[model samples]
Every structure is written in structure tokens, then in C-alpha cells.
Target: MISEKNKSNRAKQQTNHTAGRTSFVRLRQIRSESDEHLIDFFKEVRWSKKKGKFVTPATEEKHNEMVAKYSKLEPEKQTKDVVASIFREVLGHRPGYARGLGEMVIPESSRQNTVEKFAALTERAERHEKDAEYYKNQLEELGGNVEKVLAKQAEYDKLLSSYMESQRQTQGESHRETQGPA
Candidate 1:
């Protein structure tokens, strides 16, 4: 026969294991639901918004045309903004909002669109890097110019010092001459 303490310990262990399993299942279910929502949103954006243009269309003119077309659609038909607003609303419900850098909630319809938008943002960022490189080169050119100016100023300073010393010596000689036999 087992002691009461042993039985209690075994019961506790079992409870812990069961609790762990339950938590794991809950997490898995949440992830799956999130994924399903994302895929649905992606499909909506791909087929309904851009007419199945998986990648964003070229040129701002084309993009604006697509956005205008998307905006004209009904709420149920709206892919980006509606979904984004819904996602924002859900994220607002999270307690972490009070703290800085909280995790955002993804609306079922906006998740995929958000992901694709992220990709677009990254592409735009790369373009900005080209601009950054241009600025960097400009900075280097300016630095070279500043160095040249400093060197010229140093040369002028040396010349000014030598001229002042000669003037001092001439004044001393004239003082001696004026004294006459001093």
C-alpha cells in the first residue's frame, strides 16, 4: 500500500502534466486560427483588391489606381483598410497596451494583407538605401573640403606669426636709434 504523501505527490505530478498538455493545445489552436485568418485576408487582397496581382503593380500611378479601386469596394469587399482597422481594434483589447511595445492583434481578414504590406515596405526601404548611399557620398565630399580649408588656415596662421615677429624686431631697433648713445 502507498503512503498518503506518495499518492498526493503522484496526483500533483499528473495534474501538472495534464495542465501542460492543455496549455499546449490552447496555443496550437490559437496559432491555427490566426493562420486561417491570415490566409483568408491574403486571398481577399490577392483576388479582390489587385485582381490577383500577387506582387504589387509597378509605378505609383498604377498603385494609386489600385488603391482607388479598392476604396470603392464595400466594407465586406474592402481588403486593406477595413482589415487594418479591425486588426487595430482587436489589438486594442490586449492588456499589454498600457505597456510600451505591446504585441498587435491581427484581424482574421487583415493578417495576410499585413504580411504582404510588410514585404512592400521592405522593398521601398531598399530604395531608400540608395538615397542613403547618395547622402553618404555627399558627406564624404564635404569632409574633404573642410579638411582642405583647415590646412589653408594653418598655413595662414604661420605666416601671420612670422610677420608679427619681424615687426617687433624693427620697433626695437628704432627705439635704440631714437635713444642715440643709450
Candidate 2:
């Protein structure tokens, strides 16, 4: 027979596990719905081989021209806006938008700044990790208490690991932002 405490813990664990799976399933459903909308939007547009871009029907003439040009080709042959839309929508990129005389563009500068910041942060993290190692070695050479030195080294290791993991997660998020829904 299980104790009341054990039963409660098991119930709590099962509830947490179920909640996680439920949230994951909900997220998947939302993504699927979003993908369907994107597909439908893309289907209404036509690709221009000559212009080498996906062309939405801004005008009837443009639409007719695109239809005539790409009708012979398969849908696979048509230039898909999946990548472009990903950049525009998910990554918040606006290729067509420009400031007066191109003095400043928010999207372009934002992307560049983000990349630069990430690079700087990664470099700083690497430097800090090296510095931590040097300090650990110096403490050992100076005959510091072994347990204290080891504990400090462990903390440094944990910090570096967390920093690297965060960096990886940031990179993954940016990569995903530039990728179309899947």
C-alpha cells in the first residue's frame, strides 16, 4: 500500500506531465493553423520568373502577366514566398521599406545590431571563461584550500555552461525566425 505522501507526489507529477504535453499539443495546433493560412496566402500569389520574385496581384495586369508567364511551369518551379515571408513576418524584416534618402532603416539596422550584439556577447563570455580558468589555476598554485577552489571552479563552470546554453538558444531562435513555419 502506498503512503498518502507518495500518492500525492505521484498525482502531482502526473498532472505536471500531462500539462506539459497538453501545452505542446496546443502549440503544435496553433502552428499548424498558422501554416495553413500562410499556404493559402501564397497560393493566391504568382511567381515571376523574369523578375525572379514572388509577385502578389497588385494590379490585374501584373496578375495576368504572372499567370501567363508561370502557367506553363509547375507550382514547384514557381518562386515560393515562404522564405521571404519568414524574413518579413517572423524576423520583422521589411525589404521594401526605406527611410528618407535611405538615411536609416529600422529593420536593417535592427538585424545588424542584433548580430553584432550576439557576437560581442559570445566573445565576452569566452573571455570570461578563460579568465575564470586562469583564476582557478592561480588559486591552486597559491595553495588555496582545495575544497574552496574546487567549489569556485564548479561555479565558474556552471556559469559558463549557462552562458553557452543561452547563446545557443538565442542563435536557435534567430534561425527559427528566419525559417518558414513547419
Candidate 3:
């Protein structure tokens, strides 16, 4: 039931296709692709149709070129590149390379690392909350009279700093006198 054109197309597709599957199917290819294979795809590909936005044929060539070059990379370089791509956004600013900032695809590997980091951050925030509550309860137990004590504490801190500064100046002058002008 296959027409000649269909047969020719199938034959063409079967040969030199990256994985015996033509690039016709989109995101599904990403899932079946190897770990090393996806880094370039993530680099070049973005959301097509994007809820009625135009599809770009531009990234296909870039993707193909990256894939071709990827096989030549040393294993260390490959890992470094994959890691840089995966974690670049959270670490700092880089204009357009961050994960959530643009349409760049996030690697599946980042999930656990991201979750662990977020867990630490939330734990610190919770500790701060608990500390604040403890301080509030302690203040309430002492008739909530905190302003005068806090003001005196601030004055004490300033006086302590001034005293330390004067002591440092005195020691520095004595040491300089002993040195007798470098």
C-alpha cells in the first residue's frame, strides 16, 4: 500500500538518521537520547508553537552541528560542559545562559541538586523564624520592656568600639615609637 514516494522517503529516513528515527518527532527524541546526546539538543532547541508562537527551523542546524562536534569531545570536557549548562543559572548571572531565565532546557540531573539546595535554604529560614518567636516570647515574659535595654546595648556597643579604637591607637603609637621610624 506504500506509494513510490513514501518508499523513497522511508528509505531516505532509514539511512543516516541519528538513531534510525527521523527528526520528525520532537521532545520524545530527547527522552530516548543518551545523556551526552541531550546537552547539545538542550543548547539549540526551544519550545516550538509555544502556545501559538512560531516554530523555528533555525536551531536544527545548530543542534546537528553540536551533535557532530560532541562525539569528538573528551569525557572530562563533556561532563564539565554538561554541569556548566545545568547549574549556570542559580550560580550567577550570564546574560542569556541561565536555566529558568530563557527557553533553555533544564537537564534532568539538576533536580536532586536543586532540591537539596532549596532544602538547606528553607531550613535556615525556619530556624530564623523560630529564633524570632523565642525572642518575642522572652521579651513578653519581661513585661515587653525592650526599647530602653536595646538603646543601652547600642550605646554600650558604641562605647566599647571607641575604647577598642583608642587602645589600638595607643598600642600602634608605642609600637611605632619602639620601631623608631621604619
Best candidate (score: TM-score): 1
- Expressed as tens digits, the lDDT of each residue in 37-128 for candidate 3 is 34433443343433332133443443444455655667778774554443343223454344322335343477798999999999999999
Error of 2 at 148 (Å): 16
**Candidate 1 TM-score versus the reference:** 0.39
TM-score of each: 0.39, 0.22, 0.29
Clashing residue pair totals per candidate (backbone < 3 A): 0, 0, 0
What's the distance in Å from true for residue 173, model 2? 87
Candidate 2 Cα lDDT to native: 0.51
Give the per-residue lDDT of model 2 (tens digit) for 44-149. Answer: 3234445654443332343344345545566785554533343234323445442111213334346788899999999999999999999999988777577778
Error of model 1, residue 172, in angstroms: 1.5
Off by over 4 Å in 2: 1-109, 144-182
So what's the TM-score on candidate 2? Answer: 0.22
lDDT of 1 by residue, 82-160 (tens): 5434433432344333111123433246669899999999999999999999999999999999999999999999999
The model with the greater lDDT, 1 or 2, is 1
* Best lDDT among the predictions, by candidate number: 3
Off by over 4 Å in 3: 1-73, 79-114, 144-182
